[model samples]
Target: MTMEKLIRFAALAFFSIAPMAVATAQDSADYHVTVTLNWTEAAFPVGFPEDPHFSRFIGMTHNERFTLFADGQTASTGLGLVATNGRVSILKAELGEMTRRKRIGSVVEADALKAGAGVVQMTATLTSAHNRFSFATMVAPSPDWITGASGIVLNPDGPWLESLTLPLWVWDAGVDGGQTFTSPDDPLPVKESVRLAATPYFLHPAGLLPIGTVVFVRVR
Candidate 1:
Protein backbone atom coordinates (compact mmCIF):
# COMPACT_ATOMS: atom_id res chain seq x y z
CA MET A 1 0.00 0.00 0.00
CA THR A 2 1.00 3.60 -0.43
CA MET A 3 2.75 5.13 2.54
CA GLU A 4 0.06 7.70 3.23
CA LYS A 5 -2.60 5.05 3.11
CA LEU A 6 -0.61 2.80 5.33
CA ILE A 7 -0.17 5.51 7.92
CA ARG A 8 -3.85 6.30 7.93
CA PHE A 9 -4.74 2.65 8.20
CA ALA A 10 -2.36 2.11 11.06
CA ALA A 11 -3.79 5.04 12.95
CA LEU A 12 -7.30 3.82 12.39
CA ALA A 13 -6.51 0.32 13.46
CA PHE A 14 -4.83 1.56 16.62
CA PHE A 15 -7.72 3.73 17.72
CA SER A 16 -10.26 1.12 16.73
CA ILE A 17 -8.78 -1.71 18.76
CA ALA A 18 -7.03 0.22 21.49
CA PRO A 19 -9.87 -0.17 23.92
CA MET A 20 -9.55 -3.91 23.68
CA ALA A 21 -5.75 -4.17 23.58
CA VAL A 22 -4.90 -3.03 27.10
CA ALA A 23 -4.27 -6.38 28.68
CA THR A 24 -1.41 -6.68 31.15
CA ALA A 25 1.84 -7.61 29.46
CA GLN A 26 3.01 -9.46 32.58
CA ASP A 27 0.76 -12.29 31.47
CA SER A 28 2.81 -12.81 28.30
CA ALA A 29 5.37 -10.40 26.82
CA ASP A 30 6.94 -7.53 28.67
CA TYR A 31 5.58 -4.51 26.82
CA HIS A 32 3.96 -3.81 23.46
CA VAL A 33 4.51 -0.23 22.32
CA THR A 34 3.15 1.44 19.22
CA VAL A 35 4.70 4.82 18.48
CA THR A 36 3.22 7.00 15.76
CA LEU A 37 4.86 10.10 14.32
CA ASN A 38 2.37 12.42 12.72
CA TRP A 39 2.33 15.78 10.92
CA THR A 40 -1.08 17.14 10.13
CA GLU A 41 -1.66 19.70 7.39
CA ALA A 42 -2.61 22.26 10.01
CA ALA A 43 0.57 21.60 11.90
CA PHE A 44 2.88 21.97 8.90
CA PRO A 45 5.26 24.85 9.03
CA VAL A 46 4.20 27.98 7.19
CA GLY A 47 6.14 30.40 4.93
CA PHE A 48 8.52 27.73 3.69
CA PRO A 49 8.85 27.16 -0.04
CA GLU A 50 9.00 23.41 0.32
CA ASP A 51 7.64 20.81 2.71
CA PRO A 52 9.91 19.52 5.49
CA HIS A 53 11.10 15.94 5.48
CA PHE A 54 12.32 13.33 7.97
CA SER A 55 14.75 10.46 8.08
CA ARG A 56 13.93 7.00 9.30
CA PHE A 57 13.09 6.76 12.99
CA ILE A 58 15.61 5.15 15.35
CA GLY A 59 14.36 4.41 18.85
CA MET A 60 15.43 2.54 21.95
CA THR A 61 14.21 1.48 25.36
CA HIS A 62 17.01 1.55 27.83
CA ASN A 63 18.18 2.01 31.39
CA GLU A 64 18.99 5.31 33.06
CA ARG A 65 22.62 5.11 31.98
CA PHE A 66 21.73 4.91 28.30
CA THR A 67 21.22 8.48 27.14
CA LEU A 68 20.42 9.32 23.52
CA PHE A 69 20.95 13.07 23.60
CA ALA A 70 20.47 15.93 26.01
CA ASP A 71 20.17 19.66 25.42
CA GLY A 72 23.73 20.35 26.52
CA GLN A 73 25.41 17.01 25.95
CA THR A 74 27.79 16.05 23.18
CA ALA A 75 26.23 14.44 20.18
CA SER A 76 27.44 10.89 19.70
CA THR A 77 28.95 9.68 16.41
CA GLY A 78 25.72 7.81 15.79
CA LEU A 79 23.53 10.87 16.37
CA GLY A 80 25.80 12.89 14.10
CA LEU A 81 25.14 10.43 11.30
CA VAL A 82 21.37 10.79 11.44
CA ALA A 83 21.36 14.53 12.09
CA THR A 84 23.80 15.22 9.27
CA ASN A 85 23.08 12.52 6.69
CA GLY A 86 19.78 10.84 7.54
CA ARG A 87 21.62 7.60 8.24
CA VAL A 88 20.99 5.00 10.95
CA SER A 89 23.70 2.39 10.53
CA ILE A 90 26.22 3.97 12.88
CA LEU A 91 23.62 4.66 15.54
CA LYS A 92 22.21 1.14 15.34
CA ALA A 93 25.66 -0.41 15.66
CA GLU A 94 26.48 1.81 18.61
CA LEU A 95 23.27 0.92 20.35
CA GLY A 96 24.00 -2.72 19.66
CA GLU A 97 26.92 -2.45 22.04
CA MET A 98 24.60 -1.40 24.83
CA THR A 99 22.35 -4.31 23.93
CA ARG A 100 25.21 -6.76 24.41
CA ARG A 101 26.10 -5.19 27.74
CA LYS A 102 22.46 -5.38 28.77
CA ARG A 103 22.51 -1.64 29.37
CA ILE A 104 19.60 -1.29 26.98
CA GLY A 105 16.46 -3.33 26.53
CA SER A 106 15.74 -3.06 22.81
CA VAL A 107 16.40 -0.98 19.69
CA VAL A 108 14.03 -0.20 16.84
CA GLU A 109 14.34 1.46 13.42
CA ALA A 110 12.05 2.35 10.52
CA ASP A 111 12.21 3.77 6.98
CA ALA A 112 12.48 7.42 6.02
CA LEU A 113 9.32 9.47 5.82
CA LYS A 114 8.25 12.32 3.60
CA ALA A 115 6.98 15.80 4.62
CA GLY A 116 3.80 14.46 6.14
CA ALA A 117 3.33 11.73 8.74
CA GLY A 118 4.39 8.16 9.53
CA VAL A 119 4.11 5.44 12.16
CA VAL A 120 6.62 2.99 13.68
CA GLN A 121 5.98 0.44 16.41
CA MET A 122 8.28 -1.37 18.88
CA THR A 123 7.99 -3.94 21.64
CA ALA A 124 9.99 -3.44 24.83
CA THR A 125 10.88 -5.90 27.55
CA LEU A 126 10.01 -4.66 31.01
CA THR A 127 12.57 -4.10 33.74
CA SER A 128 12.73 -1.72 36.65
CA ALA A 129 16.28 -0.81 35.74
CA HIS A 130 15.48 -0.15 32.11
CA ASN A 131 12.33 1.91 32.01
CA ARG A 132 13.18 4.88 29.86
CA PHE A 133 12.57 5.22 26.12
CA SER A 134 14.05 7.48 23.44
CA PHE A 135 13.54 7.94 19.69
CA ALA A 136 14.75 10.35 17.05
CA THR A 137 14.77 11.24 13.31
CA MET A 138 16.50 13.82 11.20
CA VAL A 139 14.97 16.78 9.41
CA ALA A 140 16.55 16.95 5.98
CA PRO A 141 18.19 19.72 3.89
CA SER A 142 19.01 21.57 7.10
CA PRO A 143 22.16 21.63 9.15
CA ASP A 144 22.02 18.87 11.73
CA TRP A 145 18.32 19.10 12.51
CA ILE A 146 16.36 16.44 14.41
CA THR A 147 13.21 15.60 16.40
CA GLY A 148 12.52 12.92 18.98
CA ALA A 149 11.72 12.02 22.57
CA SER A 150 13.98 11.05 25.44
CA GLY A 151 13.73 9.51 28.90
CA ILE A 152 10.08 8.65 28.66
CA VAL A 153 9.04 6.73 31.74
CA LEU A 154 6.80 3.68 31.74
CA ASN A 155 4.79 2.53 34.72
CA PRO A 156 6.17 5.27 36.86
CA ASP A 157 4.41 4.61 40.14
CA GLY A 158 2.06 1.86 39.09
CA PRO A 159 1.05 -0.08 36.04
CA TRP A 160 0.91 1.88 32.82
CA LEU A 161 -2.80 2.37 32.30
CA GLU A 162 -3.22 5.07 29.69
CA SER A 163 -1.81 6.04 26.33
CA LEU A 164 0.55 8.97 26.12
CA THR A 165 1.15 11.54 23.39
CA LEU A 166 3.83 14.18 23.12
CA PRO A 167 4.44 17.02 20.70
CA LEU A 168 7.67 16.77 18.71
CA TRP A 169 10.01 19.67 18.04
CA VAL A 170 13.14 20.35 16.00
CA TRP A 171 16.62 20.13 17.58
CA ASP A 172 20.05 21.25 16.52
CA ALA A 173 22.77 18.63 16.62
CA GLY A 174 25.33 21.40 17.46
CA VAL A 175 27.76 20.12 14.84
CA ASP A 176 26.41 22.43 12.14
CA GLY A 177 27.49 25.86 11.02
CA GLY A 178 23.84 26.99 10.99
CA GLN A 179 24.07 27.94 7.32
CA THR A 180 21.71 27.31 4.44
CA PHE A 181 20.67 23.90 3.33
CA THR A 182 23.37 21.97 1.44
CA SER A 183 25.81 24.71 2.27
CA PRO A 184 29.34 23.36 1.95
CA ASP A 185 30.54 25.02 5.13
CA ASP A 186 27.40 24.01 7.04
CA PRO A 187 27.54 21.77 10.07
CA LEU A 188 31.13 22.75 10.89
CA PRO A 189 31.62 21.63 14.41
CA VAL A 190 31.88 24.41 16.97
CA LYS A 191 33.29 22.00 19.54
CA GLU A 192 30.01 22.59 21.34
CA SER A 193 27.65 20.08 22.80
CA VAL A 194 24.20 19.16 21.41
CA ARG A 195 21.40 21.64 22.10
CA LEU A 196 18.09 22.93 20.80
CA ALA A 197 18.30 24.87 17.53
CA ALA A 198 18.49 28.61 17.82
CA THR A 199 16.38 28.94 14.72
CA PRO A 200 14.53 26.01 13.18
CA TYR A 201 13.77 27.89 9.98
CA PHE A 202 13.41 31.43 8.65
CA LEU A 203 9.76 31.96 9.51
CA HIS A 204 9.33 29.93 12.67
CA PRO A 205 11.06 30.09 16.01
CA ALA A 206 13.57 27.44 16.94
CA GLY A 207 12.25 23.90 16.68
CA LEU A 208 8.67 24.92 15.93
CA LEU A 209 8.02 24.11 12.29
CA PRO A 210 6.25 21.15 10.81
CA ILE A 211 5.31 20.38 14.38
CA GLY A 212 5.19 16.62 14.63
CA THR A 213 3.19 14.49 17.06
CA VAL A 214 4.41 11.33 18.75
CA VAL A 215 1.92 8.89 20.25
CA PHE A 216 2.85 6.06 22.57
CA VAL A 217 0.42 3.27 23.33
CA ARG A 218 0.78 0.33 25.68
CA VAL A 219 -0.76 -2.59 23.83
CA ARG A 220 0.09 -5.59 25.94
Candidate 2:
Protein backbone atom coordinates (compact mmCIF):
# COMPACT_ATOMS: atom_id res chain seq x y z
CA MET A 1 0.00 0.00 0.00
CA THR A 2 1.08 3.59 -0.50
CA MET A 3 2.71 5.36 2.54
CA GLU A 4 0.04 8.11 2.58
CA LYS A 5 -2.75 5.53 2.49
CA LEU A 6 -1.10 3.49 5.29
CA ILE A 7 -0.69 6.59 7.46
CA ARG A 8 -4.32 7.61 6.89
CA PHE A 9 -5.52 4.14 7.91
CA ALA A 10 -3.33 4.26 11.00
CA ALA A 11 -4.72 7.63 11.99
CA LEU A 12 -8.29 6.39 11.69
CA ALA A 13 -7.51 3.26 13.67
CA PHE A 14 -5.82 5.22 16.43
CA PHE A 15 -8.72 7.62 16.81
CA SER A 16 -11.21 4.77 16.99
CA ILE A 17 -9.24 2.80 19.56
CA ALA A 18 -8.19 5.76 21.70
CA PRO A 19 -11.71 6.57 22.79
CA MET A 20 -12.35 2.98 23.85
CA ALA A 21 -9.10 2.88 25.77
CA VAL A 22 -9.88 6.05 27.61
CA ALA A 23 -13.38 4.91 28.36
CA THR A 24 -12.15 1.62 29.73
CA ALA A 25 -9.60 3.37 31.91
CA GLN A 26 -12.19 5.69 33.39
CA ASP A 27 -15.12 3.31 33.37
CA SER A 28 -14.98 1.89 36.86
CA ALA A 29 -12.68 1.31 39.81
CA ASP A 30 -12.86 -0.82 42.95
CA TYR A 31 -11.86 0.31 46.40
CA HIS A 32 -11.48 -1.41 49.74
CA VAL A 33 -12.60 0.77 52.61
CA THR A 34 -11.98 0.35 56.32
CA VAL A 35 -14.27 2.11 58.75
CA THR A 36 -12.76 2.39 62.20
CA LEU A 37 -14.99 3.49 65.01
CA ASN A 38 -13.33 5.18 67.99
CA TRP A 39 -16.27 6.30 70.05
CA THR A 40 -14.68 5.02 73.21
CA GLU A 41 -15.61 6.25 76.65
CA ALA A 42 -12.05 7.39 77.18
CA ALA A 43 -12.11 9.51 74.03
CA PHE A 44 -15.51 10.96 74.73
CA PRO A 45 -16.25 10.58 78.42
CA VAL A 46 -19.03 13.09 78.86
CA GLY A 47 -22.19 11.11 79.46
CA PHE A 48 -20.85 8.21 77.47
CA PRO A 49 -23.57 5.64 77.71
CA GLU A 50 -23.23 1.91 78.10
CA ASP A 51 -23.26 -0.40 75.09
CA PRO A 52 -22.14 2.23 72.67
CA HIS A 53 -22.59 0.92 69.17
CA PHE A 54 -23.17 1.93 65.57
CA SER A 55 -25.79 0.91 63.08
CA ARG A 56 -24.93 -0.84 59.88
CA PHE A 57 -22.82 1.26 57.52
CA ILE A 58 -24.68 2.22 54.36
CA GLY A 59 -23.44 4.26 51.43
CA MET A 60 -23.55 4.76 47.69
CA THR A 61 -21.54 5.95 44.69
CA HIS A 62 -23.36 8.78 43.04
CA ASN A 63 -22.83 11.85 40.93
CA GLU A 64 -23.91 15.43 41.45
CA ARG A 65 -27.54 14.47 41.10
CA PHE A 66 -27.93 12.87 44.51
CA THR A 67 -26.75 13.33 48.07
CA LEU A 68 -27.31 10.96 50.97
CA PHE A 69 -27.29 13.62 53.63
CA ALA A 70 -25.67 17.01 54.00
CA ASP A 71 -25.20 19.63 56.63
CA GLY A 72 -27.88 22.29 56.53
CA GLN A 73 -30.15 20.09 54.45
CA THR A 74 -33.30 18.48 55.75
CA ALA A 75 -32.85 14.77 56.19
CA SER A 76 -35.04 12.67 53.97
CA THR A 77 -37.48 10.22 55.52
CA GLY A 78 -35.09 7.38 54.81
CA LEU A 79 -32.17 9.18 56.46
CA GLY A 80 -34.42 10.17 59.31
CA LEU A 81 -35.19 6.51 59.88
CA VAL A 82 -31.50 5.68 59.90
CA ALA A 83 -30.65 8.44 62.33
CA THR A 84 -33.60 7.94 64.63
CA ASN A 85 -33.84 4.13 64.66
CA GLY A 86 -30.81 2.67 62.88
CA ARG A 87 -32.97 1.26 60.12
CA VAL A 88 -31.43 0.83 56.67
CA SER A 89 -34.16 -0.73 54.57
CA ILE A 90 -35.86 2.53 53.76
CA LEU A 91 -32.62 4.26 52.82
CA LYS A 92 -31.56 1.29 50.73
CA ALA A 93 -34.82 1.53 48.88
CA GLU A 94 -34.20 5.19 48.30
CA LEU A 95 -30.80 4.40 46.85
CA GLY A 96 -32.34 1.77 44.64
CA GLU A 97 -34.70 4.34 43.26
CA MET A 98 -31.81 6.60 42.42
CA THR A 99 -29.99 3.77 40.73
CA ARG A 100 -32.99 3.14 38.55
CA ARG A 101 -32.91 6.77 37.57
CA LYS A 102 -29.26 6.43 36.58
CA ARG A 103 -28.22 8.84 39.27
CA ILE A 104 -26.16 6.28 41.23
CA GLY A 105 -23.74 3.51 40.40
CA SER A 106 -23.50 1.27 43.45
CA VAL A 107 -24.85 0.81 46.96
CA VAL A 108 -22.52 -0.40 49.71
CA GLU A 109 -23.44 -1.75 53.14
CA ALA A 110 -21.23 -3.09 55.91
CA ASP A 111 -21.64 -4.85 59.23
CA ALA A 112 -22.62 -2.87 62.27
CA LEU A 113 -20.31 -2.05 65.12
CA LYS A 114 -21.45 -3.77 68.29
CA ALA A 115 -18.93 -1.91 70.40
CA GLY A 116 -17.73 1.65 70.70
CA ALA A 117 -14.34 0.91 69.16
CA GLY A 118 -14.03 -1.51 66.25
CA VAL A 119 -13.55 -1.80 62.52
CA VAL A 120 -15.78 -2.73 59.63
CA GLN A 121 -14.45 -3.22 56.15
CA MET A 122 -16.34 -2.95 52.88
CA THR A 123 -15.66 -2.89 49.15
CA ALA A 124 -17.15 -0.31 46.82
CA THR A 125 -17.14 0.14 43.06
CA LEU A 126 -17.13 3.58 41.53
CA THR A 127 -17.83 4.61 37.96
CA SER A 128 -16.60 7.60 36.08
CA ALA A 129 -20.08 9.04 36.04
CA HIS A 130 -20.66 8.37 39.70
CA ASN A 131 -17.37 9.09 41.35
CA ARG A 132 -18.54 10.49 44.65
CA PHE A 133 -19.12 8.47 47.84
CA SER A 134 -21.63 9.25 50.55
CA PHE A 135 -22.41 7.18 53.58
CA ALA A 136 -23.95 7.23 57.04
CA THR A 137 -24.44 5.05 60.12
CA MET A 138 -26.39 5.91 63.19
CA VAL A 139 -24.72 6.25 66.57
CA ALA A 140 -26.90 3.89 68.50
CA PRO A 141 -28.41 4.75 71.89
CA SER A 142 -28.86 8.29 70.66
CA PRO A 143 -32.05 9.92 69.54
CA ASP A 144 -30.98 11.06 66.05
CA TRP A 145 -27.22 11.14 66.08
CA ILE A 146 -25.15 9.78 63.18
CA THR A 147 -21.55 9.70 61.93
CA GLY A 148 -20.58 9.60 58.30
CA ALA A 149 -19.20 11.44 55.30
CA SER A 150 -21.15 12.99 52.46
CA GLY A 151 -20.33 13.43 48.76
CA ILE A 152 -16.62 12.68 48.97
CA VAL A 153 -15.13 12.87 45.54
CA LEU A 154 -13.10 9.80 44.71
CA ASN A 155 -12.04 11.00 41.27
CA PRO A 156 -11.71 14.72 41.43
CA ASP A 157 -9.73 15.55 38.30
CA GLY A 158 -9.94 12.41 36.13
CA PRO A 159 -7.67 10.22 38.26
CA TRP A 160 -8.96 8.13 41.12
CA LEU A 161 -7.15 8.72 44.38
CA GLU A 162 -4.86 5.98 45.60
CA SER A 163 -6.05 6.35 49.19
CA LEU A 164 -7.89 8.73 51.42
CA THR A 165 -8.64 8.97 55.13
CA LEU A 166 -11.54 11.01 56.41
CA PRO A 167 -12.49 11.82 59.95
CA LEU A 168 -16.10 11.05 60.81
CA TRP A 169 -17.93 13.52 62.95
CA VAL A 170 -21.18 13.24 64.85
CA TRP A 171 -24.18 14.83 63.21
CA ASP A 172 -27.70 15.56 64.32
CA ALA A 173 -30.42 14.46 61.91
CA GLY A 174 -32.60 17.23 63.27
CA VAL A 175 -35.57 14.93 63.39
CA ASP A 176 -35.59 14.49 67.16
CA GLY A 177 -35.44 16.82 70.11
CA GLY A 178 -33.56 14.55 72.45
CA GLN A 179 -30.35 15.87 74.01
CA THR A 180 -28.69 12.76 75.39
CA PHE A 181 -27.39 9.50 74.04
CA THR A 182 -30.16 7.44 75.64
CA SER A 183 -32.83 10.06 75.35
CA PRO A 184 -36.30 8.76 74.66
CA ASP A 185 -37.91 9.08 71.26
CA ASP A 186 -38.88 12.72 70.96
CA PRO A 187 -39.78 14.07 67.54
CA LEU A 188 -38.94 17.68 66.99
CA PRO A 189 -41.86 20.09 66.83
CA VAL A 190 -40.43 21.36 63.54
CA LYS A 191 -38.03 19.40 61.50
CA GLU A 192 -34.76 21.23 61.14
CA SER A 193 -31.81 20.97 58.77
CA VAL A 194 -29.13 18.44 59.58
CA ARG A 195 -26.05 19.79 61.31
CA LEU A 196 -23.05 18.77 63.37
CA ALA A 197 -23.94 17.44 66.80
CA ALA A 198 -23.34 20.32 69.16
CA THR A 199 -25.32 19.44 72.24
CA PRO A 200 -23.45 19.05 75.51
CA TYR A 201 -23.47 15.36 74.84
CA PHE A 202 -20.91 15.75 72.04
CA LEU A 203 -19.04 18.87 73.11
CA HIS A 204 -15.67 18.85 74.89
CA PRO A 205 -13.06 21.37 76.01
CA ALA A 206 -11.07 20.57 72.87
CA GLY A 207 -14.06 20.90 70.56
CA LEU A 208 -16.32 18.21 69.10
CA LEU A 209 -14.89 14.73 69.13
CA PRO A 210 -14.63 12.70 65.96
CA ILE A 211 -16.49 9.45 66.16
CA GLY A 212 -14.37 7.52 63.72
CA THR A 213 -12.24 7.46 60.56
CA VAL A 214 -12.92 5.93 57.18
CA VAL A 215 -9.99 4.96 55.02
CA PHE A 216 -10.39 4.18 51.34
CA VAL A 217 -7.74 2.34 49.33
CA ARG A 218 -8.08 1.73 45.65
CA VAL A 219 -7.56 -1.93 44.83
CA ARG A 220 -8.07 -1.76 41.11
Whose TM-score is greatest here? 2
The TM-score that candidate 1 achieves is 0.74
lDDT of 1 at 164: 73
How accurate locally is residue 12 in candidate 1, as Cα lDDT from 0 to 100?
A: 99
Error of 1 at 73 (Å): 0.7
**Whose lDDT is greatest here?**
2
Alpha carbon lDDT of residue 177, candidate 2?
91
**Residue pairs in steric clash, candidate 1?**
176-187, 177-187
Model 2 Cα lDDT, one tens digit per residue, 110-191: 9888999999998999988889998999999999989998999988877899999999999999999998887888998889
Instruction: Candidate 2: give the clashing pairs.
Output: none
lDDT of each: 0.71, 0.90
Could you tell me how far off, in angstroms, the CA of residue 196 lies in candidate 2 after the best superposition? 0.3
* C-alpha root-mean-square deviation, each candidate: 13.7, 2.4
What would the TM-scores of all predictions be? 0.74, 0.91
TM-score of 2: 0.91
